[model samples]
Target chain A: MKKQRNLTMAITGFVMLLVLHGTAYGLSDVFKENIYVPEKLAPTDSVLKVAVGEKAPDFTLPSVHHGKISLSQFIGKKNVVISFVPAAWTPVCSDQWPGYNIVKDLFDENDAILLGITADNIPTLFAWTNQMGELWFPVLSDFWPHGGTASKYGVLRSDGTTERAIFVIDKKGYIRYIDVHNINKRPPLESIMSELKKLNQ
Target chain B: MKKYFVVVMGIVLCLVVSGSSLAFDTKPPAVGDVFPEITFSIPGESDYRTYLGLSKGEYFSIQDIKAKVVVVEVLSMYCPHCQREAPRVNQVYDLIEKDPSLRGKIKLIGIAAGNSTYEKKVFRERYGVPFPLFEDADFELHDILGGVRTPYFIGVRIDSGVPRVFYSKLGGFESADEFLRMMIELSGL
Candidate 1:
């Protein structure tokens, strides 16, 4: 009787294994059926970081000179490019902001408004802009609540600093292009130009 | 003695017939359904160790784990999506960990597939994951959980054993909040 009970248990365990195997096979087949898109797909939902093909969330941030420039303020007249940076005095940011300032004319040629955003407070932004020899674009200060705009954009790191991400919003308020590269790497300039060129066409 | 033998034979026959009923239960996980029994191998243990052989305790079975809402993340350490999600998941984990009422009410299991001890250690150190991350060699758990790609999430209800795929890609890490809120509602917690 004991031997018979042991045999039954063994058979039951064996069958459980077989069942698991069969279920796995069917599920794997289903998994393989859904192929990945070759390029960036449209955002399923509106997230903090601007996703491609989604309407950009509107906000009113204090501009350096203007009392406040709302995102909607640019809706009908200009394409908007919000450049999120980690901080003002960092090496890469120094180079990045100056690069934007140097290309300010090109950006205008494409009918885009370039605004640099950082966690630095208004006083600090003012000081940095002066020290950096006057930036053409408003170095918008997201300072009182450091990186508030960055948080809304989903680019704020746990460390309370914004990531270096470029968001391009067309006149209609739809996000046209977004490129968020790793902190160490600068985005390819050609890619940004190409995306802008698409808007022009 | 004869009476005892007769009773034992009846019991043995019943066991045999029940054993034959081992077909797969075709009922899939509904939106809020819980899950079946799940046994995972603990990482950092001996590689030569035998497959884990144990029963689901009264409260810790897969059924129990699913009795509340759960998000099972199956990922590989080498996958970039997994790495990116690691920080965000850690943020979510920290939020839950700090809440006294929410502690232990939700379950987030990270199954690391095809990772060596070094890799798992790096992830564990970097993310400071509070829960056990079972190692799944060659994606055995991935196969069981529907051959999901790395960084995929299987959101399941604890009471119904029902599962729904919330994410199937590398970029869905940003939706951790949404995933957690849905889990809370579905788990009835």
Candidate 2:
């Protein structure tokens, strides 16, 4: 009877260990936070106002980090890649700039600087971009005139937001490549890297 | 009589534990479905040590892993959610390393969706991840895996060179210990 009791105790202890081991590891309490942004009712209409091989129209705009940034300031010094997103706090736009944030070395390797342009005001840009860690490039706002810089590049949508576009300008301020992508889709990084390679060559 | 009681009790405990873990459903290659075989490369010898068991600078395919259980993470360097989940994922890796029974039988790897080699390296360095991270620049792995969201996880059980998906989660797991336990329970390891 004592042997049977010991057996029962040993089995109970082993099962208890298993149960304790399982329960000791609790579920994480840090749930993912959701960011709220309004969705667009209609697809943006693409209208190309500028073409490659032409001189890029220069503009000065207020930056979220700095007081002001001028496109022509880097023309004689380094190549520039102007990234235009539709609006602030939206899903695709939020992910786009952060993706570029990790690739600062890629831009540095090709002797180029990235300028993120959006039609939203400074305060909105500040709140939206702060969610995306630290960004190495300047995020410029074209808010006062309502996408004036985006309009000059022919990427302004009818909804007052800019189309998802990329403009690669050479050191001499000539447009080398222009990609006006669908507002819903992300422009792949490989395409931009290849364009930058062309500029280096 | 005592031996019989011990055997019966152990069997009952096993059934109860495994039954509770099977209640959750996730995206495909659901439990028992064959995990697709994919090929990818990683830089340096250290990253390959715990993953493919290959020497430094050698490319490895899914079939090369000798472990009975494998965990694959589909992530993107530019994804904010993935960036936030990195440290937790690292903790899972550490848990697996520390556990004696799971050390050699289970392995963890990451596939960086839409990230280039340079970008993957930057993420690894920034997050201090010790697992082997591979670049899916063209998103071939992403397309093959049915376009799951960032920080997605897939756990597989290997049976004679054929991998069957045993566990899948869309987002980050709550905790490393819980995740490790789930993987072990689902894989029946």
Candidate 3:
């Protein structure tokens, strides 16, 4: 009887261990739905020391497209989508830019211009642009000063890097949408599309 | 026969001893529950067993830090929010490091979901984060804390028996300062 009890107990313990392992294996996907941000509280702010609803701070950053372009140039005509990436070669930004590239026409149809801003130097941006294909959109270099554009948007990290932030500015230069994401999770395209729809409406 | 009984008793005692270690049942620290005994290994230059571990004090039940306030930072190498908040967290670490009373009382710990040593090293070098980060590859402690995303924070108060979790979130971009201030307040010291 004693031996039988011990055997049964050991078997039960083994089963529990297996159960724990099985449950843990599915944890990442179980919590996947909790990964998103609620749409209402986006980081909508103007440049450094500036508030949202105020005119966005404008500057001319070197573009990967050959010539420098002032953000002011896009005013009154094109709704601008400014995507802030931490660095050029990082994995998240790599997927993010390509995703934007695939949807370039969608932005154009919505009367918007998509610009990717990064702290990486112009040379790195140039290499990435060339490798990533002839990017119709401009890859802005905030490199010399390091995150000058990111700082203006209050999305620059203290370590002199840009946070992954997505901002949609209306034709009148009023900030229409903002979505700052955790580095690992991709920015929600559905949310961005919805915000764009609202702006278009 | 006498020797056989002695051997059987010895075997039973060994079973009890081993079973006790395997029978750990730590409850998840909810908002009101205090932080429990945190027991995990930290990695050093040579040995994996001898990294600095948090001092084990009497367990508190109320949501509180053993010292005063505890800032639990849930981090992942792939998390952009964590990366962005890394420099900010380092800034707060500097502040906490400067204050002697708040040193051991209010603490910052980075919990990663089993990141590579190279990645972690880059994170440390790139952000200049001063606090020691804990790796939980097995998701054992991560499961206990119920942390879903990286760059998340769980504030605890250790005034009572168990450390009570006061605030918990998956990311820290919007509430960095507010969270720090709350930790300072919770740390009665």
Candidate 4:
């Protein structure tokens, strides 16, 4: 029931935000205090599945920022950082990805790329992320199969949501770092950047 | 269409309720209210540290600074509002420096709520923000400031040991000179 309601809200919210796009408020600032974040849930709900040094499971997902993105596409060219956020509109999730916008240089400097993944549908993710501001990296959805990618990563929570996690895959496709963070708190991007730096070193 | 409309109304209803609840709960420092004592990490940069009059220290509070009036811009690098207001903020800093009376008397600093150190640096580099911006990485300061929206500004008067709030508002200021004028008048400096 709650899931149905959220989908409903997500669609409407997207339309509403599109309507708000042309208003006087700066496009970037429109997201402040507007999202409906639910009360805190289990901090770390899922059991660990993937770990450091393992081959990261590759998957393809649709992206609004880009047409489609796959983990395997950057195997030899660029080190990849796959960020699996639990959901959109939640407090930490909203802050975390938008926070990545400023660190595009850090990612580029380290010759690394970032992919934001979620269990929500494309329209839902679009509605939620659009208000947060421009995201330089591609944001993909694992919705049709519904948490298929997150399940493979073992960060999918029991409640059908994914965990707040980050997986850093080296250019050679080996996982260098995995931080399946506490759901209630934000995982600092610097830690991920540090991992990127280490991979380059 | 009816179902979709109902859902939209429900979302709108929740937004209104949420805004109202936040308004009721957030009691940030008002005019004449005593500003809380919060320590900021001493800027690693030498000039900024000297500007704040901190010779050597890991942390310093607003009261520790030598200025009589302090303008605190509570912002986030990720906030487009703050990004847009960055140049105007820099202009205000320049004005303060050029104005002999305001110079050395009034100080401006930014508190980037929920931003990491690197994120703050990125914001500074991207926007050319001249003033020292302290990081509230854990959002401890943000929660203390009532979790107010970004681009919030507060003018503090530290005539005595404790800082007193003089001007507080949320969102971007239209004019830098007028904002500085208001800050000067309100701070009575």
| lDDT by residue (tens digit), candidate 4, A1-201 | 677668777766654453333111111345766665554577788887788989998899999779888889998999999888888766567667766876788899999898999899999999988876678999999887989999988999998889999899999999999998888767766788788889978
In model 4, the runs with Cα more than 4 Å from the true position are: A1-29, B1-26, B41-45, B54-60, B160-162
Which portions of model 2 miss their true places by more than 4 Å? A1-44, B1-50, B53-64, B87-101, B115-147, B158-188
Candidate 2 lDDT tens digits, B1-189: 768787867775784565333222123466677886576664566646645676665566675786888899988777877888899999998988888877878888898876777677778888898888888776667656655567778999888888888887778877888888889898899
Q: In terms of TM-score, how similar is model 4 to the real structure? A: 0.80
TM-score of each: 0.39, 0.66, 0.41, 0.80
True contacts kept of each: 0.05, 0.14, 0.01, 0.18
Interface RMSD of each: 16.9, 12.6, 10.3, 10.0
Residue A180, candidate 2: alpha-carbon lDDT: 87
Off by over 4 Å in 1: A1-49, B1-189
lDDT of 1 at A36: 21
> Residue A63 deviation, candidate 3, in Å?
0.9
For candidate 1, the iRMS in Å is 16.9
Task: Count steric clashes of candidate 1.
Answer: 13
Ten consecutive residues with minimal summed lDDT in candidate 4 chain B? B16-25
Which candidate number maximizes TM-score? 4
Q: What lDDT would each prediction earn against the true structure?
A: 0.58, 0.77, 0.61, 0.80
The deviation in Å at residue A34 for candidate 3 is 31
**In candidate 3, how many Å is residue B150 off?**
23
How many Å off is the CA of A199 in candidate 3? 1.3
lDDT preference between candidates 1 and 4, better one: 4
Best by DockQ: 4
Q: lDDT by residue for model 3 over A53-122, one digit each (tens)?
A: 6777787899887589778899999988888877665444553564455456668778988888988888
